[model samples]
Target: MSARWAADLALGVRLALGGGGARTAWARLALTATGVGLGVVVLLSASSLPHMLAARADRSAARLPVAEAAGGVDPVFAAGRDDEFRGRGLQGYLVQPTGPHPPAAPGVDRLPGPGEAVLSPALAALLQSPEGALLRPRFSQRVIGTIGDTGLTGPNELYFYVGAADVAGQPMAQPVRGFGGEPARRGLDPLEVLLVVLGATTCLVPVFVFVVASTRLAAAARDRRLAAVRLVGADRAQVRRIAAGEALLGAFAGLVAGAGLFLLVRVLVPRITVSAFRGGIFAADVVPDWRLGGPVLLALPVLACAAAVFALRKVVIEPLGVVRRGTRVRRKLWWRLLPLAAGGALVIGRLGTEDARDPFVIAGVVLILVAVPVVLPWLVERVAGLLGGGSPAWLLAVRRLQLDSATAARLVSGIAVVLAGSIALQGVYARAEGDRPPPGNVRVLATAFATGVDGARAFTTALHALPGLAGVPVTTHALLQNAAGEKFSLAVQTCAELAVAGCRDGDVYTSDRLAPGAGLWSGGADRTRPPQWTIPVAGHHVTAQEGAALIVTPGALSTAPGLALSVNATIPAAGPDVVEQVRNLIGWHGRVSSLGTERDDTSALITRVLSVGSVLVLLFAAGSLLIAAWEQLRERRSTLAALMANGVGRGVLARSLQWQLAIPVAVAAVVAVLAGLGLDWLLLTLLVHRPMVADPVAIGILTATAAAAVLLVTAVTLPALWRTASLAHLREE
Candidate 1:
């Protein structure tokens, strides 16, 4: 029996291959392979993730400095300084050797001395670029070397090591003897795991749908061919095996094509500079795990074969003609809806405090997502039945779809699932990011340096000198109080700094409330008096601005004995990079923030990814849809030709083709959007316990994107429609 099956399968492959000059047969095979290949690539990419993550983790672990090892060979004072430039994060280590033979940094040749630095390739390039002018001053140390790949997980990682004279007292600094340690073993929190699972699962589902659809592309033609084979005395079981054999060839070819495609994408991964990915991945790390890959490679062909065989169950190939069983068989609504209802109920849970990790919840979500395509055929059939009253193109399209709405629905299902998933994810993502706080017009930075008055003056001068801060007025004031146990407080600023105070540059202005010859504490108003200066000549008294504290220009304190003033620099409307530059100048322990403005890097990254990723993934669905349309065109070439023979213009046939695909696509998009919104609302309100704040912008983008994808598919299939409409095909039909 096995030998007989093999013979029948071999015959089927040859028939599918069309060893003779069979143009239509070869086209169908190629289309099937291309569709399946695209899906295989996605599956391979999903499987590669584990290896990619593990490789990255291993590299990250290897580069971590071991803090305070027992019997260390050599120790160095190390501190972590995480900084950002133009939204790209850079990891830096401040190193100070504590021993004669200090260990070198992870990728550097040796430990850096004071005034020297080692930079990553990416950072080195950025520092040399014209765009890095604002960031250049932040790393004032001379570049001695570049970090090697061994120390970096990603090619685009911004990382470096800079020499520090002393890191002993700096925040987060510690003594480290070597670099090598296991990465943190902490797993993701419950909510995070749920998000990850949902994201990954939702992403892969459409690919699988596409693959299943691909297996049965041009099924009508294949079934007719199988009927001809039956005329040549092929048994029913042999016919099934023969069909499976055809699918096996396409699936095998697709597997090879997918591997090549996967490799091509892997090569391009390093070039992706998305901030959310934290620098792009290394091509070498983007390997598919054997355990996952072996199964995937094997399963695709098997699934393809199975799908082909299963599709044949809907049609019986007799010696006379193929008879499609499902045409007259009404699709039962009860069973189709049972899965959706059960999935929704399980997924939604009991609204209150159910854990995200609940097995039923996750399974329920999966079932609901999977059920979209399941109920889609029925939905499309109903939609098609209701669709009426239009041009000949529309009427023809409606009639054709009403004949085999299931096939049309299955093809549209790929994008529908993706669209729905993307919308739900976007809603959750938007809520997760939260609403950004309204930014203050003025840039408020409170930076305190341990450096005395001379350092303070130099810092103030430096802030004025920054090119980015050109034309920006900077106002700084320091509190100067009396030491003679006087009750009044004083603030010092130049006339240009504050127009309200109106103190001239060299004016020694004092408020009318100031006591005569009050002794001032030069070191500020502290209990322990370091030194005192007498208000020698209290000449002019001006109106106090608002309260007891009064303004004095910096020139007023120039000649004061033992002068020390803590300054607060508030540069109104400072540029974005100016804050980071200020942060660099202030270094560790300094506080810098814009009042009322919040910056969440993770949230920002997620927003960026969602906007870009949805568009990218939609492209995959578009490819599948395009192949489906082409296959349908090839299968119905005779029909198109017959229409043309009946005096129907090519333009009308073209519009008919468009209508056929568009109606189902439009319905699918609407269903997807509505389903996504509903799912997002349920998840947010019940599971996540957050308000459903639907992002209209994201929704609009997703809708427009899906529409664009459909248009693209429709446009690409036009040539096929034109070719299929040739009157010669009528004779063939």
Candidate 2:
């Protein structure tokens, strides 16, 4: 506020704007600005993802309002079925409304009448193909129109609206309401929550690393400059102001660049469509709201300035010079391990607990992630101390790390976190997939509802003729009264085929009679012997006691007149193509209501998201490492040049740079691997009782990737190091 203070602040501002600096100093400042700018760009882009997805979802929902608005309304006519077409699944609905139709949507000009269907573009394309002939007969309707986008179908899914008569059977039950005209806004479900968390983790972790690395760029040069000001009698407060000013300069520039980048990216994002979503996000949605974006843009400079001032805390600035004040107290090794221990304990305690919330699990994961950076510096220091004297390059590298192990560790911290995540996810994915049978090998169950015995028999015969079907078991339903006069529905399968076709249990003919006092009768010794005729109950007796007992008997079809027949067939290869074929053939005789395959689509989706997250993390880590390495080389230019002038070979200098980068990364990688394994073990115990299978190939690849990233970064700095060690650099120093 005083005149002198005002002058000092102005001087600091000028200095930040390159009032007195070498060309290289300005270049380093530019690099720092660029890094910060890109970090902000990435942050904004990631933040906009949720909005973009929502916009697309809204667009889809708007097109299917009739389906959306059907809640609580009884349908005049309705029929729906799920079947596979070619290699894709298809969901078809047939409706004839007695009341007013829904308002026209974006995709459909008008509703289809009898014998006509409106299909999604994807379905329309399929029907126009040669293979569409196989699928056309089932619908038995001409395609009248195409839907552009609708919530009733996924980007990759097939959906159609047809006349009521197009479906094979009369409505079995009232049609479930579709999403009404209003877009159904819902909070994130469990799976979606996991996706958002992982997505944020992947995007933000890199930004954090970039921010830290950028603030540290040319730190030594900045330190020396600040030390000169202290030597000239500037107080600590003044020194802090100068450093803050310098940081703010770069941060503000970065903020402007970031905003520009966001706009530029928004221009291109609308053109890019993700197959996972089956569409591109609207460009307007990708724009960040200024109410939120404004604060974020302003906060970066503030944080950068704070980081700069914080870095100066350990220095003792005297009128004579500045030196780092050594501390008598050392950070205890055990203190670094506390977070890891606490996190591991939390995970172990919570595993398989009934009331465990997802937030609790995510918190545990956070603690584990935090512990890596916390403990890494200490580990690096200890490992560097253990390495004995060797080549000059090795000694120089080891000594440098021992002097400031934290900085060395910080350089590779991003990769350490990424590696940890990738390894843990790999273990979880492997264990999840291992517990299930391979897709091609698992069996599929298809159930058909037929009107009578003849139709069921025909369906069974057709199922037997299908290429992949193993067996067709047909059963007849009838109401049978027990001696107690309690009636239950009985499903009768042939006694001769019971051994191989129906329930393989030898007690198939045994009576499970319900008693008045006791809950249910286990077969009595007297009833164990095969009788002239036996009834086998198949479902829950308590529920069955309310109705007729479901009995499986050989003579039910012959004796029980007018009974409905159902046939179930097992197919060995339950691929979409095979399932579609089976559905088509069975449709000729009966309504095929339910078809289920062994494949876990949820697991597949999780795997895909994990893969994308892993790739993003790798890119972020690699970028941070590259920036940090270049900065380090620039900071050590004087020392490297002096060493070269004294006859230290360039090769030794190059090797020293590699060693400095490698030792800390290797330590971090080992810790990461252990942390990853521990996390995976805890997750598996919570989710399933599966063996911990370490995928060696995945582990090896992750380890190799870490090493490759370090190597590549080190290589990038070698040419710069070579120039820094030249005579010109020495003279300038």
Candidate 3:
């Protein structure tokens, strides 16, 4: 053991300063540092996200105050609290007031007797008051008091606070009452999930960086007079220990750099958001938690060492003479390219057929990711050959990509992943950009109101007369229970009977167990408690028991008892010209909304997210590309030196080097486009199981962008490549 340790230590000391191993060690450290820094950034960000989410959830839950309830209350209420509050819950209150001025808005000067409640900030804002006070209407002395924010009873609503007592007298839950449904109650926040995904992905970087550097260094050591060590009684194990130890040292240095970067990002996120809620810098508090940090710190080094150890085994088993020539994957090119083709097909098909705006974009991203490794080698070879034209230095530099396909693949793989992620995100954003509202939606919403039947007919007449207008009115309605358990109005539009062209379906469906067109009356086993009523909506009916109703058309509702119906028109294909004409014809009598508005909003949000995500991906990709280029240049330095000795000009050599990098990037871009199509197809499949309705224009744009990226990368590397190819000083050295 002592002999082995001494031998390993000596090798380790020599590797730290000897020939190429010394440079390789430093290079490995640099590469690992980048990866570790990314990992740490992702780690801190991801950890804080979940902690922040939980904290926010807890805070919001606390503010509700109903979790404090201890004794028996309504069975439903008790059941709801069971999950959130393990022990005693908050006391629930119901205060009904009989006072003079019923609560109109916030802040009222002394109601008749018991004061009013401060319900929600939204209510306060709506009422144009400060404290949400209500003067009991027609009653001499009675009032309810309350606090906190609650949301109105509706889909996609903001939070508002409402007390049972505050709305006890109202016919329905004060316009917005939801005791059971809230956004908070939904699983985890999506943003938190995104952070986790980022962290998990970044963790693999150090492993790759360490493995590649170690492999290269180990190969070099054999040729540089280190081969006799094993013959001189130094076993493979000792050699491996030395190599792995060097990797460990590099990993530790990287960890420090990574930790510092994580801290910086942590500080930045809060400043960007600027709110009362400060996210955990390390998880749930100001102080760092080892439960999270320990895992990170320990995991990074372990991953690095494990990667090094695995690569070291390859270094050990091989005979020194052959291994000195360098390692290679003895596989056919066709075998590799086949996977690339399959992946490309999937990616291209997806990008071609699906809505770029769908979450399915992520799937397309994955396909592109899978295809990259298969395509990279050939791409590098082709690009390098092209760059090698007429330039000896560039020709030599280009051989690095040609002769060592695996190394090139390794170097380029990171860039491929980065590019895939960015393009997928960008596709999402671009589609969104086309759909963004023209600043008119928000302003128009305030002036517009749902139209009555006659009002709709009148508006439709004017709309049809408008220039560029060509569509019939599409109006639908729904019967839904109000917060106070009273059935009232609900409605939506079905423009052109197409889902995407600005048409939404109301949430009204027949209960499969119940018969169609059956009226719900309070009675039998399932029907005993306000038995639901099923009514015919249009030609095709929805089953809604008496109390539980479904959607209907404005025309259909006209026949229903005590039902006042309204009509709305939708122009799915309408443009600015038609919109303006319709506006003039309608003369401000009814509300006008373009389906485009919603699409535009969705697009804007998608763009923001894609932009941020793409930037990070680009950074990672660029770094990988640079590392690959640098290593390639270094590995083939001798070849370039020979060319310099042969009187090959540095300029030509640089061009060749540029071509090598450029060609592979271009090839990857092409493969990416093909993969993008598969991505589009996958999305289209999700939209409709049958044949796709592909967007040719979108395909064209995607292809163009990918091609452009390849060109851009090539342009950026040309000058530096030329300089590297010029072996004037290298030859002398």
Candidate 4:
């Protein structure tokens, strides 16, 4: 901590980094810095996402003015339209501003006047296109300005903001409140948070592993240098300080490079939009917050230094030579199973409980993922020890792995995690898609919205006219004025339909006062008082109260003043095209959607996200594995040269390298696949009780990809191995 000591440490760091004019040493240092820098970049980018997304949401919310104060109540009027624009369906909003637009809102130059609208930049660009002109007339509005990062539209979606007066005479079926002063919420939901965590974990895990692995790159050379320093009258503390200083220097350089990379990426993020709920995130939202980013940058160096210190733990700096102290206590295989056992127990326990949150399940899965690497070293050590004697190449590779199982395990850890994630995601996707009804048997529930008794009859007639349609049930509701002239909505459906729809006691009613052929009436009478008549439908014996008279048939619909007509029909053998046609036909009158469409859409989105994450993780993992392999080969050059001098063929050495890489990878792949499937089963059992389905194709692809990556990395490093095995390397040694 003294000034003299600090100056000495600085001198040592400079000498270590300068590499005493050795180009190979400088190159190793540069590669280490590059690895650390890349890791830092990914970490910072992932950390910034939530903040960026929230900022976009805030900007969009700010576009709307505060709600007007209506005496004691705040009056907020809003309208939305679901229409196709530029060949894409979008939900558009119109808000009644109580005051002028806020200047702080992004992309709004001024408040939109009646018949004038503010379009998102994407929508504006589309509207200005020649193809967009053909659709412009239908919107009947002038685009006054463009909004950027509104957060209400996707990259391909069309979203426009207009004044409430533009939609004054139009019916606003759905009301949007809470758009006033501050947006009620600004953050990710539970599922979104889970996904973000999952993505970040997947991305940054490999980066961290690479960074740690990078510190140990050329470990033999580092140990020799430290040993020389010890022989020159330096104590253990001084040697450790010098080594830490070297790591810190590389890490600091990496942090700077990473910061530069992040800034460059920030500029490009605005151009790339990823779709999710509330539209997708814009580039502007992805800019790293310095508060969070600063810590991440600072942590990288600390972690690098710590890893360096840890790697040096077994290395003893003696005057004679560097002695790596080997552990007397061998790691037991059962110790590795503890995490998996605990995680499985947690998952099983959670399944017995009702309303378990997703985070708990994610935690359980994470535990299982963590166990893969934990158990790998022991497994590799045991496997390599058992399979030590085969061909000369096999014996050489196995003995090398057995000698340093920890390093062998580290090489394939990334691939293990990625493989496990892919398998688990495949299981989840299978379970989700399994619930989807088969084609031709997919039920289509068509709902038609119309007004008046005549409209109900017309809608029903149109529904029945469709070929291959069945269960053409129609329900009509009226807004009735009571004796006090107070109006309330009442649904008119027969007792049979009400029973089938699972209406509760107070939710359904029948009356003897009604004509024999009339349908049942509900929800207009006071719940505190009894009605004049109470009767049950033909099938159920439980119904007691008759709030109002029934109008059983469409012929009796005209007796009451009908407010809205809801006609339901089912198409059992409809194809997607036929279903689309039905939807379009019903949409001509009102909003229409088939049953389970929303659920299916959500499941598909989740599947896509998981699949993408798995692919990215695999790519990153492969890159890390390649870097580790190259570094390992470089460190083992002297050993390889010695082997070559002892009559070992280049081909045998090459095969040995491949086997060394392959042994850990093959073991990790099997463990990962099994762990992945188990995790998937636990997740599904806890969430939804769907049957377990193994995806052999996905498993095969994952295995083949991991194997191919190992082979490719080995092939790429073979030239390095050949050079290391030559007389030049032996003479240098």
Best by TM-score: 1
Between 2 and 3, whose TM-score is larger? Answer: 2
The local lDDT score (0 to 100) that residue 335 gets in candidate 4 is 75
Q: What local lDDT score does residue 368 receive in model 4, on the 0 to 100 scale?
A: 78
Please give the distance, in angstroms, between residue 666's alpha carbon in candidate 4 and its true position after superposition: 1.9
- In angstroms, the error of model 3 at 253 is 2.4
Listed in order, each prediction's TM-score against the native is: 0.82, 0.70, 0.52, 0.71
- Tens-place lDDT digits, model 4, residues 422-525: 67666656655665664454455565656555776777777767665545455565443333434433455654555556543323343433323223222243
Residues 543-654 of candidate 3 have per-residue lDDT tens digits of: 4434334443344333333332334555555444444444444322233453333332222333333345445545545554554456556556666767767887766666
The RMSD of every model to the true structure, in order and in angstroms, is 6.5, 8.8, 13.2, 7.9
Query: Which ten residues in a row are the worst by lDDT in model 3?
Result: 79-88
| Count: clashes, candidate 4 | 9
Candidate 1 — number of clashing residue pairs? 0
Residue 9 lDDT, candidate 2, scale 0-100: 56
Off by over 4 Å in 4: 1-8, 59-67, 70-78, 82-89, 94-118, 124-144, 150-157, 162-207, 273-278, 287-297, 325-371, 388-396, 420-589, 600-615, 638-655, 673-733
Estimate the overall C-alpha local distance difference test score of candidate 3.
0.43
Off by over 4 Å in 1: 19-23, 69-72, 166-171, 181-191, 292-297, 325-329, 349-353, 435-450, 464-613, 731-733
TM-score (C-alpha, index-matched) for candidate 3: 0.52
